[model samples]
Target: MSSVSIHPTAIVASGARLGANVRIGPYCIVGENVVLDADVELISHVVVEGHTHVGAGTRIYPFASVGHQPQDLKYKGEASRLEIGERCVIREAATLNPGTAAGGMLTKVGNECLIMASAHVAHDTIIGNNVIMANYVGIAGHCRIGDNVTFGGTVVVHQRTRIGAHAFIGAQSMVDGDVIPYGMAVGNRASLAGLNLVGLKRRQFDREAIHRLRAAYRMIFSNEGTLRERTEDAAELFKDDDLVQDVVAFITSASDRPILVPRNGQVASED
Candidate 1:
């Protein structure tokens, strides 16, 4: 293990594992089962408790609470864990809780994620790589957030919702359903606004792929047939288009929450 720096005011339990160049700032508290990987920095007044494992190169700003017991009422002193991936930035006053026995016993935040100030990641939630949650975003328990998803400030997601990769939730939206990959949702009781065209362009998706995805999206959401039938038609029609296939597969998958629809359309549940 490389040299670790501990401020005199910090209280790191003896059983905690600190990797090389880890810095525990003043007034921080690290619990016995906490693991801080190499180059991890707890800026100040941070509390890392429970069986939390923070990956290398992560920075936690002041007043963040990590690896804490879940907010679930059923979580009765279970041995759950919170695993944060490398190079993530957890901003001030963010709360990340561990999973519960009912939901796999692990809460995972993937690499390169940016969780802004006052964001709350609830019990059993799984957040994928490169996700960005703006300030005051609250994700309820058992939610799944895919890679490159971005949430504007103060977005609140209901429990068990699944948001696919590259999706965007506009500020102050209340998300209660599944959001498809590369989709954009907005407004209270969030509805699918459109394709995340800007995100696709920023990610440099080819023009042809974007065009096909748009075409398939229109077909699948059209009023011609049931959603399941439309999804099946899209799957067959866009067999060669990976982007279209991804959306089609997401629609076909079984989920408790309905797939978000356009602002004026009926909710798209499995037909």
Candidate 2:
């Protein structure tokens, strides 16, 4: 391998594809089916196995277990894959599992993600770009995490849940349902607390846009009508607002889980 660096104590198995400038640190183990892109770094004691493809410039910290087989009892060693995007930082002891046949045979983490220590990404989960998961965050199988989402420490998401873009999951939350984009959720069995105003401000959304989104959110969640009716109204009202439309689209999209709402708001109905 030209320009690649493997520590003397590391074991890079035969048939592993190592791109230029890849670094396998001390005691790291890379499996035969693994493909490490250029400038990838597997820090000490990291185990990257199975059919995993780590993108360029990604850094996996010590003791991280990446591309492990699915935890599903139905998984019978299918050739599923774990694909991690570029420039991700996977911290110590984080566990990322590959997909299962039932979940499309792929688990994907998008570019520029920061997975903190002890976080777990289970089989078939799709994490979007620039996402951040704090320590002890456990995402169950088949969850869809949208771009720029942030998870506070110890957040636990149920299987098949979808968290929309820019949503914030507070510490110690147990998310069992779908969360809308730019929403803030907290508490055990999380409910929509409010908009992620801080995130919107930090992301530099204009005041008028934020104001419109806030108005749409209140209208959609108010007790005047069914969630579907409210969402339809919001869709028509915010026709020119992309941000509000995103929330409306997410609400209208087919989902197995209920859309989480504020505790005082009307319950999300299937009709």
Return the top candidate by lDDT.
2
Model 1: per-residue Cα lDDT over 1-271, one tens digit each? 4499999999999999999999999999999999999999999999999999999999999999999899888999999999999999999999999999999999999999999999999999999999999999999999999999999999999999999999999999999999999999998999988898899999999999998988888888888878899999999998999998889888888887999988776433321
Candidate 2 has a TM-score of 0.97
Whole-model Cα lDDT of every candidate shown, in order: 0.93, 0.95
Kindly report which residue stretches of model 2 are placed more than 4 angstroms away from their true locations once superposed: 266-271
Error of 2 at 206 (Å): 1.7
- Per-residue CA lDDT of model 2 for 224-266, tens digit only, reads 9799999999999999999999999999999989999988674
Which residue pairs show backbone clashes in model 2? none
What does candidate 1 score on TM?
0.97
For every model shown, what is its TM-score relative to the native structure? Answer: 0.97, 0.97
Q: Residue 222: error of model 1 in Å?
A: 0.9
In model 1, the clashing pairs are none
